[model samples]
Target: MQRIFANRARTPEGWLQDVIVSVEDGQIASIQAGQTPQPQDRRVDILLPSLGNLHSHSFQRAMAGMTEVRAAGKDSFWTWRTLMYRFMEHITPEQYEAIAALVFMEMLEAGYASVGEFHYVHHQPGGTRFETMTELSDRVFAAALKTGIGLTHLPVLYTYGGAGEQPLSGGQTRFGNTVDSFAELVTQARAHASRILPGDARVGIAPHSLRATSPRDLAEALMLKDEAPVHIHISEQPKEVADIQTWLGARPVEWLLNNAPVDTSWCLIHATHMTDKETRDMARSGAVAGLCPITEANLGDGPYNGPTFLAEGGAYGVGSDSNVRIALTEELRTLEYSQRLRDLQRNVMIPGEGSVGAAIYLDAARGGAQALGRQAGHISIGNLADLVALDGADTALCAVEGDQLLDALVFAADDNVVTDVWSAGRHMVRNGRHLEREQIVSSYTRAIRSLIDAI
Candidate 1:
């Protein structure tokens, strides 16, 4: 079906007057500008390329607000992690699918057209493997298929509880898998992914983090990169940085840059602490720094050096890492706000020559597509027809034109203005609601109740 999104804004090309986008077989066939809409054409207030969440742990969505209660002492990321571990112990495959379905639904409604799930919840409660190795991953895939969200399934390799080949903590057992085992699991994931969504879904490898995998194991897992994207957690916290130094004699990002072929196929999540050299090197390497600003702030992780990184020509993408809040506007807002707070300046993330909001939004869209290995993030011809339409009539966005619309959408308007979202030309969200929102929310409610009771 061919649809026209008239008077929509296109980045790098100002407001296209009466733009008629033709989508065929889930791909944009052609996009004609300066064309008037016909009677059969569907007109929307505003159209923009949807954003991709480059880093996420779908199951974590269920635990979003559950860890807010303050313990006796100061609550830190480690303390929150303890609660997260306990939460993971009781999740069955059914609960995982339920929680993930709801999470994907929320993501779609939040203007995210695709998600890269950095999945690691692998075995059952204890160290025991399920009958199917890809049980949790299968649930993730099922949820994405049900929600019609583009998925990049990254099966995480979590071998150790901390830096070295440390003994797996009781709560960490389910996530542990040897290098060989992880390779086999990746193969299984690829086969499972091929059965659904074809080229739209990809199976990649995620070496959980520097603390979770050994140097040798990290090296071995990189062998799975045969044309697939590789994502890894790196330097999110000061403690992680200290531990990596103790274990590997180098910081996480520095070590990975020195050791692996860190290229465009790699996305280093949260390189929060880095030397100037590491920042410039990472930017030059063509790898994306997957920034989850809301989650980072919630967890008190240090602010990333956005100004320096961007000045060095680094690429980056945003994600709702913990799904604490799943709005693309919030993510972009928080990302820029964090940079502003850090540098004591305004509009720190945008390049000198472009609009701050447009630059951040477009950089995230492009970097996320590269990170997820998808031909999305743009509304051009031949790209995946994943588009989002904003209610331009909204008071906050009224009179906004060109890059100003993007600015308003990112900083002023909330998710309410995102009236429609289409993934691969399939409308999963309409009138600011996901198609399966009610059903997924009900299932999630039951799952969350059960999990709370179990805990």
Candidate 2:
């Protein structure tokens, strides 16, 4: 058993001082406030429940800066995606693993304790399968183990290249899979994760998006879904929404709500474009809106309907989609700022009154844990000990207390203010640095060098 003594810690009931939290076998055993710290206790100034990155494509981290060039015409998400597909085709399995390790390490340092890796790259270039079908998934697990971050491995089932059941072509060929094969892949991934990853690690399914899978394929994929999470991309781009509406005869969110079992177990990634009706209905559906503000901004995806969604009691969580920038504070900051910029108002995330930072931060912690099927979110007993500690001494967080501390974290500080992090009691980060950062970064540098040469 290990103990953490925090001068101030956020609990489910409220903020408490001089808190002592005990961890036994990765689960939080007890939390007592106004307690004396033992000599062996790990100490920190400010402790908060670390947020999970609810969506990611870890392999895309390597291509972050390469996509920023303006295309010949007006650059759009589709054009950015075409370049992404071409870049991914050159990534070998070893390079993919290296890139995942670097991304996971970066996530830990960025105060994201766990990640919902929406893995889609499966086959070799030209749609050829490896002798081991689970090669890429195993690579993800290996990277997770190397980094000691909590893993929710979401194996993506991408059946088609585009809307209307378009056949797989070009770079998308790597992600194609039949329903039966996808089921087997999920099964094998579950077994692989169980064997190697920690007890809290999970295997989930992602049916790519409404555009990538037909109704029949999606239904069959959902049939393969077990008790774990089910995520899907939806309504990120105007073109995507228009295409989905034209092909399916309804908008993406509308069709999913009417067609599938859209519930709390589902995390709809990037429901950015939606009607007023679709927003309210989706909020009422109990599914998490997995927002990736940084990537959305990078790809020119529009802002989500924040006010309407929150008014309807919607749940939302932040993610570093595309792994473009993996800063948790910036993600939350961008989310609130997006709302502010859109509505032309201040402190827009909370419904009535209170700190906007605390509202979004705590809600994201809970929603992210729920989305990844992780028993964490609160600093409470019986939950997994997924936690982060901030340096109160930092200039950005100095002289702040209560909700102001969170406000500073979201609005003022960078990820450098994150001093320590634990994912399910695995203390992989200390003093704002992941323990294995040097080696992981070296491997990634080598991989990226080789990948650049290959491309």
Candidate 3:
């Protein structure tokens, strides 16, 4: 089947006029500029490559609004984790699949074509393993398959509760595993997911955080570095920085840059707390900083120094880390907005002479592709046919072209303008709605209700 997209706003070569994109066999066959659409071609108003969510914890989507209430003292990421652990107690494989399907559907509606799921929940509530260790991972793949989204399945290895090889806390039991066990789990996940969607699904490795893995375990996990992309949670909170200093006499990102072989294949999530030296080192290493702006704001995580990082040529991509909210526009907006608040300057993200929104969107899209180890984040030839068509007739987007269209989409518009979405040439969302949203949401609602009742 061949389909063509016409009247795109932005492309690799800036704004194209009367462009036509051809897709065949789930890959972009050709992209021709100044071409009129044939009778058989599908015409769209505004076309752009869909985004890749570089970091996510899909099952955490169910815990979105449940942690909003103020706990005993000052609420923080640590308090949120307690609620998250409580929520994890009731998530069966079926519930996990349902929740993840709903979350992925939301991602499609929000203009993300793929997601890097930083999955770590492995065992039953009491740390008991299922007969098949890959049961949870199978559920994740099932969700992606049903939702028509590309997946970088990163199974996390969480050993200790914190730094210094601490024993696993009660709430952290389900996420704990030895390095050997994690290697076996990844092997199982790769083998099982291969039958589902071979090329569309990637199995990666993630050591939960510096606090959770010892130097030896972290080194062992890096042995799989050549096999797939490696991701990890770095210094997101000030306490985490203090803890790292206590344990290793250096910050998390600083230590990782010095110890680990940080490269393009690595994505350090929440390198939010870093010194000038650490930032410069990360920029030179070509590793991606997986920023989740919305989640960071929700958790009161400090803002990332976007200007300095970009000035030093650091790469970054956005994510829906906790799945608390899954809007590409909101993530981009929050990222810029956070920077604006920090720097007290407008248009701080744009370096050269172009639209700030377009620059940010394109950089994130490209960096996200590198982070996920996929030839995606563009609608060019030979790339996966993951595309998004915005409603060009929207009043806010009226008179928008090139970078202006990107600016409108990221700033003025939300998911409502995203009229169509295709992941790997499959129309997962049309008319601004996910194909299976009703059914998926119904199942998710039931599962979440049951979990809440059980708790």
Candidate 4:
């Protein structure tokens, strides 16, 4: 058991002062406000319910800066994807595990208590089968174990290369699996996760996208989803939207909403190209819009339909998709900044006149937990202890309290303000660093050197 005495803390009821949070068995046992700090209590200035990164490809953290250089002609998501496929060919299981450990550690240090790793890279190079079917999945679990970050392991089903049953090519060969094989893989992944991961960890399913799987296969995959979270890449690029529309009868979001039972359990990643109606319908559907603002801007993916979605009370969360950058405050800042850039207005994320920082931060926390199917997103009793502590004395945050303090966090502060982080009661980060930072960084440096040399 542990007790955290916070000078200020954000609860579902709103911000409270002099709060003491008790944790037992990885859950918040109780929250007592107006309490004095005891000798045994861990002391913090500002505490928040940390958000989960709802979407990530942990292996891609290794290729962050490699794709920034311009190609022969115009650079787009497609061209970048081709390069990503090539780069992924050189990652061995050990290196993959090493990369994931670094990514997870960085996430914890960035104040993200958990991650929904949309893992798709499955096989050995050249589509050769590894002796162990869940080789890469177990490696991801191992990384999670080492980092002590909450894991929502999403084993993706990448059946085809494109819309209308296109053939698998290049590095995609590693991700291809028949529906039956993918189901078996999910079962094995679940067993491995239960065997190796903490109780709060979950295993979910990701059907790569409409372009990568047929409707029949998608339906079958969803049947295997049970009650777990389901994530899909949808309408990230105009070309993707057009291709999916040309192949299917309607646009990607429209088709999914019309055909699938997309409800609260679904997270539609990048729904950036939706029409107003599609956006409103998606909001009404109770599905989360898994927005990765930095990655969207980096890849030239268009802005999301924030106005219509928010007007309809949509659920949404943020992620460091490609991990080109991994700062929690920056992710929230970039999200609001993208809205401002698109509409040429300030304070656009909030519904009326409240603090946009508090609104986005709380909404993203709740929506991210919903998307990952984790019982978190609040500093309340019985919730998982997914929490972060910030240095209120930081120059960027010292002058404020309540919502304005959150505003300072989103608009002015860097992740360096994060002083401590707990994922399911595991205090993996302390004083702005992961507990095993040196070993993780050394392993990543060696793995990245080999990968670069190979490429």
Candidate 2's C-alpha runs over 4 A off are none
RMSD of each: 1.2, 0.7, 1.2, 0.7
User: lDDT for every model?
Assistant: 0.89, 0.94, 0.89, 0.95
Worst 10 residues of 2 by lDDT: 64-73
Q: Which residue pairs collide in model 4, if any?
A: none
Q: Would you estimate the TM-scores of all the predictions?
A: 0.98, 0.99, 0.98, 0.99
Query: Number of clashing residue pairs in every model?
Result: 0, 0, 0, 0
Residue pairs clashing in model 1 are: none
Error of 3 at 200 (Å): 2.1
Candidate 3: what lDDT? Answer: 0.89
lDDT of 1: 0.89
Better of 1 and 2 by lDDT: 2
- Candidate 2 vs. true structure, TM-score: 0.99
In the range 253-313, model 2's lDDT, one tens digit per residue, is 9999999999999999999999999999999999999999999998889899988999999
Determine which window of 10 residues in candidate 3 has minimal summed lDDT.
Answer: 1-10
Candidate 1 wrongly placed segments (more than 4 Å): none
Which digits, one per residue and each the tens of the lDDT, describe model 4 over residues 16-125?
A: 99999999999999999999999999999999999999999999999988888998889999899999999999999999999999999999999999999999999998
* Overall local distance difference test of candidate 4: 0.95
